[model samples]
Structure formats: C-alpha cells, structure tokens
Target: MTLLSSCTRAARISAAVIALLACGSVLLQIGLNLLGGEPLAEALWRMSRFFTILTNLIIAATFAVVAGGRSVAPRWLLAMTAAIAGVGIVYHALLSHLLVQVGAEIIANHGVHTVVPILSVIWFAMFAPVDGLRWRDTWTVVIWPVLYCVYILARGSVTGMYPYPFIDANTLSPVQMAINIAGLTLFFLALGLLLVGMLRLRGRKSAN
Candidate 1:
C-alpha cells in the first residue's frame, strides 16, 4: 500500500483502540458504582454530572466515528480535543489528590483522565484534519463547558450534589462559583486556541 494509505489505516486502528479504552473505562466505572450499591439510575445520573465521564464519552464517540472511516467536522474535533485535554489537566492539577481509588476505579480514572486524553490529543495533532479551522471555532469549544456549568449549578441548587468541589454551590458562594466557571471557560478557550495555533503553524511549515 502507498504510504499515505498505510498511515490512514494505522490511524483508524489507533482510533479504534482509543475508542474502546474510553468506552470500557466508562462502563467499568458504572459497573463498579452499581456493585457498590448505588442504584442504577442514580449512578447513571451522578456519572453524567462528571465532566470526566462526559468528555470521555465524547472522545469515545468521536474516535469511533473516525475508526469507522466517517468524517468528523474539524471544529467538532477541535472542541473534543480541547474538552478532553481539559479533563486531563483539571483532573491532574486540581482533583487527583482529592480522591483515593483502587482496582477498577484506578483503571477507570487513568483511562479517562490520563490515557485517553493524552492519546486523543496526540491523535488530533498527528492525524485529525484542521484545514479550515478559524479563530471563531475556538469559541465553540467552550459551549459544552459553559452548558455543563449551567446544568450542574442548576441541578446543584436543588439536589445539593456537585460532581466537582470547585463549583459546588453548597460550599462555594455565588460569586465564587461564578468565578470558578469563568476561569474554567477561559482555560478551555485557551486550549482550543492553542490547538488551532499549532495547526496553523504546522500548515505553514508544510507550505514552506
């Protein structure tokens, strides 16, 4: 096979592996939660509140599509990369020390927060298309995080549960919560713009 075609095939294989890792990790976590006596519905609901779970699921879906040889929008890929990157960064930087895990939980945690995020970003940098990315596309990356903040805050207002401590409404004041959300939003935007900038630079080098 030609080199380009061979690379494409290899990329598809890598995508499939990443997809399986993400899906399996998420499923394992859910199973563990159920085994730990969390009601199935409640476990699912609580898991959904976590940005790690949601972002991993998004990564799984996006890679699954690529593995199936389907095209993904460049902007969507950019958003996914940024979101997953944030998942890894925020986990390691802010949350890693707050929790203790063993066995399957350790596997699940690393899969979503470490392994998958690193692999996804590498995959994007190496294989994903970015031919038409724009500065405005960076804004799209924050949409998911913004909506998540709104949803979690709204639900926390009634349920008194939060997935992450930083934005926990019960402990944090209104202004503090807003500040946390804004900071996270800016972080996501910065990641997106950074990815776009790298891609632009790569394109320039290719043209030279």
Candidate 2:
C-alpha cells in the first residue's frame, strides 16, 4: 500500500513533462512554418524531433519510477510502446531520415542535421528497467504520448505538415491511409486510457 501511494506525484511529474514537450513541439513547428525563411525547414525538423525526444525521456523516466518500486505499468501498454518504438528504432537506426537527405538536397546541402535518429534511440531505451527488462509496464508511461499523438494528428490536418512520414494522408492510397490513421488513433486512445486508469488506481490507493 505504501508503495502504491508513492507513485502518484512522480507519475504526474513524468506526465507533465510529456505534455510540455508536445505543446512546445507543435508551437515551434507552427512558428517556423509562419517564418518561411532560410534554415526554417531545418529548424522545424529539429523542433519536431524535440517532441519525440521529450516523449522518449518521459518513457525513460516512467521506467525509472516503476523500477524504483514507485509505479507499475499494465502489460498491454508496455507491449504497445515497445512494439511501436521497436519498429521506429530499427528503421531510424538502420535507415536514413528523409528530412536530413531531402531537405539538404533541396535547400541547404551543407547544413548539419541532428534530431530524429538521436531521439529515436533515446526513446527506444524508455522502457528499460534497471531491475530487469519489463514489458508489463507502459500504461502510465505512455499516456501523454498517446494523447499528444491524437492532438498532433488532428491539429496537423488543420495546419498541414505531419511530424513524421507515416501518417501523411496525401502520400498514401485513400483506403490505406484511413486504415493507417485509424489504427494509430486506437493506439493513442489506448495509451491515454491507460494513463487515466493508473491515475485512478493511485486515487484508489490514496483513498484507502
């Protein structure tokens, strides 16, 4: 019970970090889009990567909390974050970022680019448990991530320019894109619900 009671404050801290990161990323991209000057695309891309990085940091901090015996994650949430980041980690680790390549070719050929891949690796480690590798814990950790994804997707359509390549509706076949977006949306929804559940659990623990 004491252990259960301890997780709430720390958990909220992790969550707040994620919220700020998401908001910051979106705002930065919006600003750069408006500016439309030299180095703007690179700036936008870098700012966008910070959102992903903060998310990864949040995940990392979540695991740190859980492993400290302060929190526990539901099995499904753990599996989902791991599964999603796994694919992303592999691709970014092995392949190249289009922004780095194309933006260089089209705009600034000699500029340095350091954003997506670095954050991808950082977020990939978000689920690591010091006690051991634990896949049963993603609920609390991934909540902000999922919610922000929805916020971004919905907002992106209105503003234009998605954070990443996968969800660009214009680039995909119509049927396929809807299916893709739907699936992604569910994952985000699940993440948000899981976080809410953990907070509820914390409440219950405190009430007792």
Which candidate should be chosen as best, given TM-score against the real structure? 1
**Candidate 1 lDDT tens digits, 60-170:** 998898888877778888888999999999999999999999988999889999999999889877775546687777998999999889888888888889989999888
Mind giving the per-residue lDDT tens digits that candidate 2 earns over 31-130? 5455666376666544544334444444445545443555443443344354335334434543344544333232211111123223322432332222
* TM-score of model 2 vs. true structure: 0.39
Q: Model 2: clashing residue pairs?
A: none
Q: What is the lDDT of residue 129 in candidate 1?
A: 56
Instruction: Summing lDDT over every window of 10 consecutive residues in candidate 2, give the lowest-scoring window.
Output: 106-115
Which prediction has the highest lDDT against the true structure?
A: 1
Each candidate's lDDT (Cα)? 0.87, 0.44
Task: Mark the regions of model 1 whose C-alpha exceeds 4 Å error after superposition.
Answer: 1-7
TM-score of each: 0.92, 0.39
> What's the count of clashing pairs in each model shown?
0, 0
Error of 2 at 160 (Å): 0.5
User: Candidate 2 overall Cα lDDT vs. reference?
Assistant: 0.44
